[model samples]
Target: MLALAGLLGLGGTVAVQAADTPAATFTVRQLTPETALRAVQAALTHCRGLGYQVSAVVVDRAGLPQALLRDRLAGAHTPDVATRKAWTAVSVKMSSAGFAAETQAGKPMSGLRGDPRFMAAGGGLPIEAGGSLLGAIGVSGAPGGDADEACAAKGLQAIADDIEF
Candidate 1:
């Protein structure tokens, strides 16, 4: 019985040690400056091809704007809106459509929609690599959210080789 108790104590100690020590740390890879710039340029090209003046924004994993560009004729609010949309996507790690669906279903997003820097619309896309979220890209002022999203998708596709998704 004493031996059994000792074994149990040893097992408990090992379990506690394992729990205290982290097995691994998770690190998310982010987009490089060149890749981010390319995404913005691609967005611009796609929007121009559709004959729409638009703004494009790229945000880092933490939802901070890294790069932004607006067409000369784009609305004054285009840049800000695009940045907010990008922030929303990066924060949520999902497409704006997914976020909208969740919001519409009455899911709580920690008041993200109420935050000044968040946009729940469908013009934002999460930049992912190796099943990890890197950042997001948003396009705005393209006549409609779908149009803006399409342009953003094209931009992401342009950098598909460099990015994970």
Candidate 2:
């Protein structure tokens, strides 16, 4: 009986050890400079095709701005806003609408709004490929947020073949 009890205890310990092991953590890969430039250029071209003067921004996985450009006729702050919107999407790995929902649930992320680098708006989108997050693209100065988001989405779609997220 003693030997049987000891074996049971050992088995229980092994079970607990298995349960305690943490799951593997997946790391998001940052976008390369060339990929970032391509995304930005695509966004710019799309906006121009729409006859819209706008600014577009690309950000790496860490939410840092990689590239930002404003059309010559865009407002002075267009580039800044676009960069902030891109940063918000990359940092949170979600669209600005998701952030807004979280805030609406009494989880105030007003701190993000206060930060000059964050823009919790609809013009930003996460750049995901192969079920992994690569970064984000943001467009501003369009006629509306929907239009801006459309341009950004087109940019990501253009580089779909090159991105593995």
Among all candidates shown, the one with the greatest TM-score? 1
Clashing pairs in 1: 129-164
| Alpha-carbon local distance difference test for all models | 0.86, 0.80
- Residue-wise C-alpha lDDT for candidate 1, range 63-100, written one tens digit per residue: 88888989889999999989888888888788886777
Q: For model 1, what is the C-alpha lDDT against the true structure?
A: 0.86
Model 2: per-residue Cα lDDT over 113-141, one tens digit each: 56566676778999988877778899998
Best by lDDT: 1
User: Which ranges of candidate 1 are over 4 A from the true structure?
Assistant: 1-20, 23-26, 108-111
Candidate 2 least-lDDT 10 residues: 11-20
